[model samples]
Target: MGLDWAYFRRPYEELHDRHDAAERQEYLVGRQPTAAAHLAELAPLRKREPIPASGYTGDDERLWQIMKLYALSRVSDYLIELFCPAGDPPPGFGVTGGRAVMEGSTTHRLELGGWQINATPGWIGSRRLELDELAAYTGFFTDIGLTPFEHAETFSPFHHEIFAVMQDPSATRVILEEVLWPGFWFGDLLFSRAGVRVRAPRHLIDAAVATTSTLYFTFSREPRPTSDLSHNWGSNSQWRTSFHRFYSDEDGLHLNWDGQVDIGEDPPQQPADQSDDPNPLDQRRELLLHRCFVRSALPRDEDDRFPYDDRLSLTTAEWPLRPESIVRVPWTR
Candidate 1:
């Protein structure tokens, strides 16, 4: 079922009422607003029930799984609209029946409504190309957690796991460019799905970076090192010494470049297997549905967000990045 817009509309009104009141106070008199307010504004409309595990004869759980995924995708899109810079993306940014249709399918630019990079006034061809390239990664999966199956036959499970990690902003962007985008590009052989173009308001990115740095460095780090965990401690030690460590760490992640590693190697091509290989576009659909899967699994407890299955780490081929591209990071990052 689609969003219960009527049911969800009142909270928006309440938020606006509060916002207007706050504005009249010169944004000063009341308790400082927080993301909690934003979360509460968005929380009421989501589906909270489960599909019957045993409903009909031969009813596989996949249908319920698909429904859950659909819900997550819808919610993620809604959240992005709410939290991400652009407000209320146009209907065009979404797919028909509120579904993610195909692997390489492009969404209507809802937030940017007819304000495409190519169409934006004063945008040069290079800028347009960059946006297109960036969108190849971000627009398709912005704040969404689904993974495509066709591109990487191995992706079905891994994508679900990554979607879980995306709940954390720092981890979200990091995983998108690292684990997800590269997989989409080399696995699906799609050229544009290789990088992220963040058009985020500078302040939000800055705030996120600030929040993340403190969390990762001071809070998440271990207080002392043990011999068994020496590697982790060493890494944390390296991380602690960096300038504005969080920004540097996140910048490296956003760019997907560590510079410690060498670049210039070609992605190894997957050998065609007739039995397992499906149509390339179908693979893209698999990928999109995987994203839908993640979207449907939202509002999970923080611990549930990163379901790292051991099966996923079995192969390095599941991750891919062009050697040359690795050396050249996105200018925006």
Candidate 2:
């Protein structure tokens, strides 16, 4: 008995009140014409000025703008696998049996298990608004100078990306609150991360999870069944690969920078047969499975998966914690 259908069909970069980011960048070049012809060879470096405002005269032109943001991050990874298609969706996409709670204000809309989860990106209306108008038609990366960020105070899985947690257990720490999307770097190379919403601290979470109303990396507020592998590449070598960064610093949290995920400075414990962990799945159960917002078991690597998966699972598990009532879990360790 849940049928609003997020208003039939919305995201073509929004209309009604007018927002068209060039029709979501021409609907990603009419849906991936070889990553939209190498994202049209960066259209004259997105009309120049990513950094040359009298800067970077040498060092090979700042290593040629980090190799043109690693070839425009392979058209932002084939435009988020042609619009967020990784895993878990369709067992009732946004089935609103209600109950998952929290409606407005914090803007999370969030809910899980009872299944209503979302972290904004098109909110089930326009396929995650094509990664928020393809990150504002790729300007967020600052046209290539790189820096585009978005913070939420604290909850570092090496630059957020949790999506929702909300379980107080007295809330001693791990309280970010919100930040739907925005991550960029290219220098330290953490190309993407920001997508938060947390509260956490219930003997280390497994009860309050969030997200998966069709979300994985980015895009999918509607238009479910997504897929990647650059749809099998070779169509111009999938626009030129390399650009799934998640690195961090001060010495840790490199979620996957081609060393193939799991670098860590924390988050690497829980293994009571969470499928006997294997094949490089650490960083503390992948930051306690994104601090328990389960879309579980991923690190099997299609980029990353298999740290554990049952689509979702975690709870109480033989409880025996209370580190001075956790004022910290800075992503475990």
Candidate 3:
């Protein structure tokens, strides 16, 4: 089934309006900070004013405001990651693998053994045969603050947790000041290895999501004790290195960033067998992490770092946004 674009259109507008009004009220209440103001500036789609969703009209500027917010919300993950503290790979990850075998067979079938068995024409005997097998493998590591969920950028699985913590306005501000700016700056440094930098208004970028909209993904099963894939071990180590280059978020392993990243030369893709296929992994998570960053950052290098967001925002675009469907089946000789 396809998205009910017509139905979706209305809700999208409504959510955008509500979010904008709330933020505006906060701004007027002297609750707004420079970071928020910076974020708010980028709400509208650059060249076009919001066209009313079909069947709505009049003085509902709120609709326009919200529509803009909805658009921005789409990239919230990137903005949040950019702003939140990251770096220092998360604990407990790397090289877990295993295999499982089926113990039962539901049906019995007789196969003719070459010419000898055919001539005999008798059951080899109702014996169990081994065939079906599944291989299980897992790798673990903290991805820092990378969104485990990837659907809408502004949406997060931890939104409730963060909001609960931000019940106090002061706390929210701290997040903006300490977490947001530095986190964002560091994210730029990490990805810029491939010469990509995305700098945009954070609020405007955040407003683009529907509140009901959320990122959903199935996490891989926890790593098991089996064979080891150590090279693939280490969680977001490269990302951690980038973060440390800027600032240390806490102590020990964590890191943060204080400013914009310098984009240098493009880095070659790591060997596929070395690290998981970033594209496929990005897809299973709906590319929420990758996409939000791309949308928020301005790509300055020849390589724009694969636009993972394009993979996540599948609802509006053409069908088959889910990458796993593209997995190939081996041909039999």
- Model 1 per-residue lDDT tens digits across residues 1-333: 332323222332333353332242332213223312332333222221222333213354333332222222232222222222212223322110111112332443221212232221110111011222323334333222223332333332222222112123333222222232332221111111221222122222221121111111111111111111112445323222211100112223211111121112122122243122222322222122222122221121211111110001011222222122222223211
Worst lDDT window (10 residues) for model 2? 310-319
lDDT of 1 at 205: 27
Best candidate, TM-score-wise?
2
Backbone clashes, each candidate: 21, 20, 34
List the candidate numbers ranked by TM-score, top first: 2, 1, 3
| Candidate 3 segments whose C-alpha is farther than 4 A from its true place | 1-67, 70-79, 93-333
Off by over 4 Å in 1: 1-58, 87-314, 317-333
Evaluate model 2: give its lDDT.
0.38
CA-RMSD of model 3? 25.2
lDDT of 2 by residue, 1-333 (tens): 222112112222232233355665555444444333332343333321222333234343333433444544444544443333333333423211101223345446543323454453223322222365555545524543556787656656556555445566686666667675676664555566665556656544432223422223332222332223333566444433333334444433333322212223224343354443443433334433343223323222322433222111122111122223122112211
Where does candidate 1 have its weakest 10-residue lDDT segment? 305-314
TM-score of 2: 0.25
> What residue runs in model 2 are displaced by over 4 Å at the alpha carbon?
1-22, 34-62, 70-156, 159-169, 172-189, 201-333
**What is the total number of backbone clashes in candidate 3?**
34
lDDT of 3 by residue, 264-331 (tens): 10222343344433333422232232222111122222122332112111122211123332221111
Please provide the root mean square deviation of candidate 1 (C-alpha atoms, Å).
Answer: 21.9
Cα error of candidate 1 at position 107, Å? 29
- Whichever of 1 and 3 has more TM-score, that candidate is 1
